[model samples]
Target: MSIKIKDFWKAGVVCICVLMLSSCDKWVNDTELPDNTIDESQLNSIAMLGRIEKGAYIPGPVIAGVWRAGATSAADLLVASGAISDEIVPTAVPNSPFYKELDEDKLTPDNTSLFSVWSNIQNYRARAEDAILNAGSLAPADEDGVKVKQAALVNARLHAGYAWMLLADYFSVTNTSHSIYADHKELSHQEAYGKAKAYWEQAIPTASDAEKRLLHSLLAKMGIHTGNYSLAVQYINQSFGASENFSFLNTVGTVSNGFFNALNVNSRDAAVDPTLVVALKTTADKARNPVVKAAKGHWSLTLLKERDPLVVSDYEEMQLIRAELIIRGLLTGNATDLVNSVVVKYDATGLSNFPAGPALTLNDIVSIRRIFLSWRGTRLIDLRRFNIDGDLIPGFTQRKWQWIGVPEIETQK
Candidate 1:
């Protein structure tokens, strides 16, 4: 893989100054290191370690300036995933064949959009590893410094874990082979998830209370992805409380939220599926699926502002996971109440409940998730979980690609 040294410097310099305080003066003033190279030894202090961890979460040079670390990447993933699934339809305005190819289920290794997602995520994982290594090398002189070092290590592990989880979720095994390439080796989906699980487990010893919740939520997601309902419930029990409203967002600093910019500001690269639009006409549905008219005639999601943080995980997702487990008979609880809890929280009049009966099927849960979790970027995983075929809109057929293939750049290596 090739490294964009210029891109690294551009993002790194801004991130170092923005994320660190006066503690960065020594590192910034050092002129011995070449402008193009960042010496690992200089990243010795706890402050520098934190800076490196934060850098992993900011937008890197991918798709020019549009693609970012957390939410932006999540947004693009939603577009591709929604296009492939039933939640979104491609538009010609952006004139990017990538969206259209995804809509038609003709994913190729050369899809730049997928490459952007792959590269940015790999960058996040790599930088996170760098932070971990730097943390290990640091010898804190004070208790506060030790805490900072520990926090940086935990945060880095969380970022690295999520990177692997995303790789496992979004990319598929090609030619009945590897799903992704890392460290010059190919990793299958299960192998990737295993790596994610290990990282999260390692962080458990030093993670704070808030970080622990995030870890459990992530572990629950991994269980869901792997069809381990028992394991999902195990972690879900240890995750955020129902009313906590916990969320983990990837901070982009000065980078624009690429998903919002694409849909509303830059161009209408993708539009809301007509099926969802019609469903949103209902009062309760409208509340859950909040959207506004874009510059073009299509509807754009208003759930996130242009600079709003991209959600990594939240309590709503935890509730949905718990509800699914209840429906699956793996856990004991009123799945209806759990589902309605989300509906009531988002809907204005609280009339969106599913008629309070046993009639709720897995499909009902999936539909509710599709609307409530629309642009949050869970649709693709949901589609894979449900083995869904055909678009939500009537008469639209889904194509064969369940997971995006490895980008061409990686394959050539």
Candidate 2:
């Protein structure tokens, strides 16, 4: 795969990383220093390790067409998954067949979107593992290099663990069927969460300030996925300052933030699912008012122009998590007040296009999350996690982890 960071690849420079071996023979051959092998001396140096780390992040598009997916291109996955829930609806249903399948919740094993997600996640996991294990083998030449190499390894492990969590949370697979490692081991959800937590724990002590903040945010997410709300709240508290929000960057040729291009530019899908407006209309709450405007018979989400950065974690999510904890009596606060504060803040700042209504509750919290996290992804997961799959919305379907379609590469096993 080629990575283009603002036309640098056009300058004839190739970014290459030693990804996990495809075969046991190749794995063994790596130790013998074959002709194609990365130089051992280079691998031992901190400079080369830094390059490998950057290579892992280069957005390599994976699933094409309707099921666009990539290693780093999670925004695409957001849009695709949004179709499965009542968060996003397709504009051209007849032309875009995947939208119909996603809308109806009829996913086959060979579904292109599922296959793309499965393949890309495994590759990412392998790449991260390669970096972590290889980096462990070398000692840095200087103290600064040692810190840099350690940070890279920490980030690599975090990425690998996250891939495992995504696989476990989003797909149903057996150890023998969906193995990504040479050993052919597939982890259960609990096992995946365990691995993710371990990686975060390993990185925390040595991580730099910014890296540590990211680790905390990710750990909080893992906690939410694993049904450990208390842990999630604890981690979110340590994540960052109340005002801080985090985003990952994307470039034009190298990384097209696929959410904007596919939906707005290509005109392939509708901006916002119309259900949010419909739900409020029927709720009979006089105080309820959300800020979705109709354009040409559909909601106009024209704010996110092309080239907008995607938020990785934000204060809205952190507070929502806390609000849920408060509602459950696990935390000490008025859940309504906490949720309304966030909602009012979003509306006051005009940061969120969706305006907050009066006298909010837990349901409002969920609604605000759907609005705030619209293309940020988490719609289907929230539905599944809350066990309200077929509720709330009229035609909602239960989204659950699915077994992967047999890939061509798996046949080699």
Candidate 3:
């Protein structure tokens, strides 16, 4: 919401053709608007539009359900039946309007309606990219202008990365239909994943320090897709080191801000918009909605529901990534000892310390991430990636789009 930039980067740039270039007069020998009059003071309307669009990007992550999901238990209607498929559950899904991350396995390309929300996500990403290109180029003597442009650029690029990440996660194999994406013909599984990775990497340099931290977090997500836990840890760690402002409430917008309205629908929202995951504890703390509330996955009913309590802290992600790397033998030090050190900082359970017994399992390290980064939308990516690769990660079931979840269910009416 708030933007900051260093001093030299402050000025906003603008340029206009001056009429006086044709004349050599001394007094009035300056720029002129049109034929006789030039409005040098007017702000560029295109830039103003770009500015507005840039600021609107803050909501991309939370609305799309990029945070953790407890199998769509939060929504009364979706999870009540207990099937928990993409059709009925995860209503706040990334590509779904009524669910979080629709089942893409059962999908078909010829049908237009089923593909709507997925298309919308892609649109959101395109819009953010466009806004960044338009306004991010502005430069002028105004110190505030520079900050605004830089912030806009970062916002657009970050959101772009977020959107692409969602698409990469959903299509275990990228969609090849001409109607699906920018190229019309979908890419190979590796190609789609690579595109997502490249976008996030490209964004690192232009993003602000705070944004760069977030970008690093997203980049680690890409690494996870490639099964590169070491690289994932590297990016996640950098995010923790650089970000001074990190919290669920602030890192993402629309946590409880009427984003749930879309849950009333039956189709996936869009592909390019990063997804969101929201929780409800119920008055009785029954855990009726999301179903799984284990130590790490659980939500506290006593705490406020409007903002994310499991708000992302770079430290939490760093610890988990480090633990994973250590478990994978990427980091040489004791994983058990390392896991112990990280978990304490994570929950601050006040236990004496983490046990220095034996090396840990993938689930053990993931549990640390699960407990610490709950509801922040990071889990979906994890589930979609490694789980798809045939790893036996817990609570992940692969569901692709089938006609039942989309227009087949809707267009019939």
Candidate 4:
């Protein structure tokens, strides 16, 4: 694509947005940036693309902040693992039981969590769309620039579309046609899902090898959930060889250089401390704001890995896709495609575990997702989308949470 200087200036000015339901029209379009030296070539620069993509994951906590009540969203797993359950909000006083019950679906929406992850996803999607738009407006000419731009464009769309999908599937509400730029009309449940799939279709072709694999796996979710077995298989094939390893951070003992310390804006994400949890729970009666100081480390170690392996893209994801297609009656492809992917190719002696068969199951797929995504901020959407086993979430679904009781002030006894 040819890039006129004016177009380059425009691209740099307005940040991209992804939420179609509530699209953002940036003000920068009216006010140009002071540094107008961006070129189409920058899109391909690893240095450039890396910097831009960092924005996507960094600000995610802004949305998570609300989800965890007053605590950071980082507490998501810990809450789910059930460590901080008794760190009662002093406000939880008499109403806490009924209200808490309601929040967890043990009660109802009459008991809503502090925030709607469903709605927050829209904001996230809009942010992603903005990034894609930036990619589109780039006048990238170099080979590397082309690759990075295309990858950015595809991932940007993927993030936006997935956000919308999460919103529709998880929440009690559903409105997909809300707008890519502005509200057009309210879309039904299926319509919104279709919109998400359509967006995924358009963007999938442009993804990098790794991204393609990730999308391929994700497409299976959207398609299978919707009964489009064949479409799911096709997308899965498109994503072959995407990931081959999975790894986790080994940060607990090395706190000063750990992942928690790196991302903990509040300096509160320490390793699981049983004593701290009990201490905070007991002090609740004397506390002010009780939500922030409750459980310190119940779920933090749920699946804590000493060292996460880099699970790269492999044919295994494709095999599972094929298998699901067969189960759904959409494809006649040999199940070997699926079977071979999971067959261990190497043993302790480093020989092929060869010709493995039917070892994978639906449970296996879920396990893979958990290992792969870990605490990468992908679970909240899934948890909202009918919970772990495709069971409808009870109206009283209490999302994972953390409560840091507001510290007490000294008083003369």
User: In TM-score terms, which candidate is top?
Assistant: 1
Assess the local accuracy of residue 46 in candidate 4 as a C-alpha lDDT between 0 and 100. Answer: 37
Q: After superposition on all CA atoms, how large is the RMSD of candidate 1? A: 4.9
Q: What is the C-alpha RMSD of each candidate to the true structure, in Å?
A: 4.9, 8.6, 12.3, 13.7
TM-score of 4: 0.47
Which 10-residue window of candidate 1 scores lowest in summed lDDT?
Answer: 58-67
Candidate 4 residue 271 Cα shift, in angstroms, is: 15
| Ranking of models by TM-score | 1, 2, 3, 4
Model 4 local distance difference test score: 0.38
Ranking of all candidate structures by their lDDT, best first: 1, 2, 3, 4
What shift in Å separates residue 278 of candidate 2 from its native position after superposition? 3.8
- lDDT by residue for model 3 over 127-191, one digit each (tens)? 44544555644564564555556555565565555555544444322223311233334344456
Weakest 10 consecutive residues, lDDT, candidate 2? 58-67
Q: Which candidate would rank higher by TM-score, 1 or 2? A: 1
lDDT of 2 at 67: 16
TM-score of each: 0.84, 0.73, 0.55, 0.47
Q: Which 10 consecutive residues of model 3 have the lowest summed lDDT?
A: 1-10
